[model samples]
Target chain A: MRTLYQFHGGVHPAEHKQESSAHPIVMAPLPTQLIVPLQQHIGQRAKPLVQIGDRVLKGQMIGQADGATSCAVHAPTSGSVSAIEMMPMPHPSSLPDLCISITPDGADEWITRTALDYQNMNPGEVRNRLRDFGLAGLGGAVFPSHVKLNPGKLDKVPTLILNGAECEPWITCDDLLMRERAAEIIAGAKIMQYLLSADAVLIGIEDNKPQAIAAMRAACAATGFEVIAVPTRYPSGGAKQLTKILTGKEPPSGGRSTDIGVQIFNVATAYSVARAVLHGEPMISRIVTVTGNVEQPRNYEVLLGTPVKELVALTGKQRNDTQSYIMGGPMMGFALPTDNVPVIKASNCLIASSPSLFPAPPPALPCIRCTQCAQACPVNLQPQDLYWFSRGREFGKAQEYNLFDCIECGCCDYVCPSHIPLVQYYRFAKSEIWAREREKQQADLARERHEFRLARIEREKKERADKLAAKTQGSKAPAANADIDPKKAAIQAAIERAKLKRSGVTPKNVENLSVETLKEIDEIEARRTQLKQAMEKQSDSPK
Target chain B: MSTALLIMIGLALFLGLVLGYAAIKFKVAESPLVQKIDAILPQTQCGQCGFPGCKPYATAIASGEADINQCPPGGEEGIHKLAELLGVDPKPLNAEHGVPKPKSVAVIDEELCIGCTLCIQACPVDAILGAAKHMHTVIAKECTGCELCIPPCPVDCIQMQVVQEDLTTWKSKYPLHEIRNV
Candidate 1:
């Protein structure tokens, strides 16, 4: 017997598994119209490949995987695409997203599928094949499984933990899956083990479901895989907690299980992988536990994009006392804003809420800081401090206290004597942090572009100034030459007079002058003659 | 006694020299006050704070020539941040400046735009991209939601549109039960 290790803090919520797990899994009838959301998983939204009026077969890829971290979307049944537009999604925010509405042709036709011999094929090829098959973690996170399989840069994965511990109350999709399809799930686990090259495979199912444990143990008996029954604790099924229980290692904060040489996948996800690899069937349906307030509470193999209202109608009529419907487990699930939203890959259970099942939490009172919340925190964080910081909108302090490390399992909220709705506050704080981070990124980009604009404007201004200076210089050169032209003309006239005097040419006007003018001219001539005689005497003396 | 006193004085002088050297050696180069203030202000550069851009406003605040509450884009939160950095009491946003409103980006009606380049020159962030006598378009991501370009639009084709919250930008303000009675 392998000894199990313990985590810091946990709570024991009511299992509530018997309501749905008693019956075998039943295939839900295909709806008339299927509203498949383009963004059913995390990361980038898939791009739609089909247009309205196009025909599609069952399991046909309708939305193509966009980026490395995204997965594709497939048609749940043979159908004709009707409308592809923004429709309300099954989200806590109740926001509208692009969805492809399909009208089934009742033929239930399927596209051609060829099963691959994964053992003989290269591991990378197998992973790529799985990528387009629309396989993701069905364990509420809906993270692309192919991305998780690579374990990037890590040479080896020591252990692969398969989570069958449906710890949250009123959620038994995994339990029912294990009970009914244990052999298939084991086959899927083997495929995953082969892909990861993990040394050991451990399937950790909570002890609350003894039947599931027994079935899984029997299926994995002759195989190297071990089905370990962990203690039934709320959130023991959490990836990190289950890893710790089975392997005695805690994944570091904000790090992945792959960092600790371990990786976890939901049993349903493993089953989907088995189907994708061995049977070449894309993920189009999942076992969803539809219970609470309905006449017939059972697990249904619901097709993706089936309306929640239609699925709830299958479990008999909802009681008059039923107030609302929650999409996942009681602890982690949120109430569906409307029943018109379609079920996606991540939805595991739908609980028809009633007053008795979930009484309205009383008005919140002031915190006395009794530390009960801290004791119940599975992550071992100070819940009271986070609560105070979140309330005061002191995001920096909240972040310093490691607010993002919170798994939001509602352990703190369950134990809070003050009824503070602690998880809601944590969610609020997280959203605010994300919003601010986005804002900061935008501001940084804006700042860069603004600075670039300023530099360009400055360069343009300088260029304009240089061009203007050049033009002015070009115009001023002619004006400067005009001023120099008069000086040149005066110099030219002086040279002409000197040339005329050397030639000894006397004008007729000078000879016809009056007697007084002649006398003046004779006096001038005598002076000029004397000047010439002086110049000649000076030149003769130098010789 | 005199010899002991002289020795103590010499020791004191030696320690003072070491301490002064350490202070100079490990001194941190502080970022200038203007840069720090500029970081807190939203870089809208709308000139609503009576300055050319966020940097000039930051310079004015650092020089004590402008009040901390003058920025409407930063709003009350901006004032609080400035106050915390300057060690002064936070004051409400000055009403003489524009009132705090939802973030908006200017949208140009391309058909109505007569290719006038006035809005491009008026835009402090230069988010508008167009030439004279050509259709101008706003780079939505680069736009700082500053309304500086509205007045310079010759054909009155510019309009300030509030940014709509889509799924990407939407955050659940509160749980449904808390918001609605049901």
Candidate 2:
């Protein structure tokens, strides 16, 4: 029997997960138009490799990985690029970003596929291949997997934790994926363990997901990997939370799991990695849970960049009383701006909301200074203090209380009787702080540029003054002038020639000049006399 | 009586010397108040506040020659910060100087630009890139929208354009509350 370690405070929100977990995963039909956002992961946006009007085959690399931190983006199916323009992104902000829109030809043709012998290949090469395969944390963080695969400073990872918790309510994609593709997930786990040289592998599944646990356990038996069933709780699926539940060690403050010689990956991510390594398939699709207010609440293996409206359509018509749609789970999901936005890599669950299911909250009353939020905070942060600091725009105080560690799990909001939107305030403060830092950097850059310009100007002025002084002091100029660069030497010679020509000009061609030429010369002489008068006036004035 | 008086005078002299030495030993070179004030300034260097640059304006304010409300780029938030730093009541921005304007960048129409190099000299931060008789372009990121370049352009090719608020630069509004969705 594998022992399970418990973490700090966690709430057991009603598990609506079984509504979708009971059904088998289904492949979502390809939509007419696909909008592939280049920046699906938490890194630099991928650079587009194809232009509008270009034909792309299924599994073709459409966007190349831009940097080591970013992952590549691939075409979902055979299609022609329709528009490379700004479209709404699947984020809380719902702002338009650069997206490559494609129109499918319905041919579903694929590019040539060849599996790699990663065993003989170098680890770096395997990681690079994974990046090109567009693998990211399919657990909804969407962090580039290649960056995480590197052992970093750790000589050897002690334990690799596969998070099968799927703790959030109404999110059952991971549970369904594990139950069906347990062997593939284990294969991917082995690959990751090999990459990190991990000594042991432990799989943590919540007791509520009995089927998933049994499936993963049966598959792990062959590999001698341990599968532990942890208690069902909200946010147990979080990387930090699950790491604690399995390994009983907390990653130090502001550090990664690898800092403590441990690393965790979502079961869905493992499944994708196995697919990429064994079949040469890029991450063009993912399993998404479509539940809540729909006739058939089930999990669908949906293609990447499929519009939310189309994917939800496959789950059948939503109930008539639906009020809104949310991405992610009820605990931490946000209201989508529109259903027209295409699903990106970060999307995991799409829940249609109704008045009865999610009744509107009462008006926010004053903070009663209650300590319920503090007691429920899993990270041991004082949520009430963070709320006050964030609400009052006292970001320094918020930071003093470790505002970033709150995790925005909405636990405080869940327990707050005042109905205050505490998490929004925290988000606002964090973004504001980030913006201020960026502006400060810009100001420093400007100061440097301005100071450099001033210095250059002063240096040039002194050099010019010295040159004029030499010319006026009876021309005892150095013979060293001859050794200067040809460009400067030519400039000096040109000045001398111009001076000579001005003092020694003769009117040899004046004898054959016509009346018009004589009139032009008279005009030129008048203009020069005006210029000389202006110069004399400037010299006569007092300094 | 004369001996007693001389002894008292000697004690006073000794104490005065000790005090003078302590003052010199613990003396600070300068106050950081000026640098702190300068930091609060937006560093636009636009000269709208009757000073040549942000540093000069900061110096003037430190010496009580300039008011915090004279800077248009800094706006009301700046005035409030300056007041907080100096421990004085916040004052309205001086409209005689200028009103606060949105952040902007100067764009030069290359077609109309005759390459006069006047705009280059006018730019306090040297954001413009060009040589004599060559088309100049503004490094948009470096431009502080000082409007100094606009007046110096002989062909009037320079224009101050308000920077667009896009996703890359978007920030969440403070305390944005909707229908109270948790």
TM-score of 2: 0.85
Question: Tens digit of lDDT per residue, candidate 1, span A201-272?
Answer: 999999988999999989998898999999989889899999999999988888989888999999999999
lDDT of 2: 0.88
Computed on alpha carbons, the lDDT of every model, listed in order, comes to: 0.90, 0.88
Determine which window of 10 residues in candidate 1 chain B has minimal summed lDDT: B173-182
Q: In candidate 2, how many Å is residue A247 off? A: 1.8
Give the poorly placed runs of model 2, Cα more than 4 Å off.
Answer: A474-543, B1-31, B87-89, B176-182
Candidate 1 stretches greater than 4 Å from native = A471-543, B1-31, B174-182
User: For candidate 2, what is the total of clashing residue pairs?
Assistant: 0
TM-score, chain B, each candidate? 0.79, 0.80
TM-score of chain A of 2: 0.87
Q: For every model shown, what is its TM-score relative to the native structure?
A: 0.85, 0.85
lDDT, candidate 2, A1-543, per-residue tens: 766787787888888887887889988887989999998998889999999899999999999999889999999999999999889887777888889999999999999988878888898899999999999998878899988888866667888989898888889998898899999999999999988889899898999989999999899986978999999887788889888888888987778888888888899899889889989999999999999999899999888999998988888766789877899999888889889888888889999998888887777877888888888778888888888898888887888889877788888888888888788788888888887787778777776777788899999999999988967763455555756665677799999999999889985788888999999999999999999999999999999
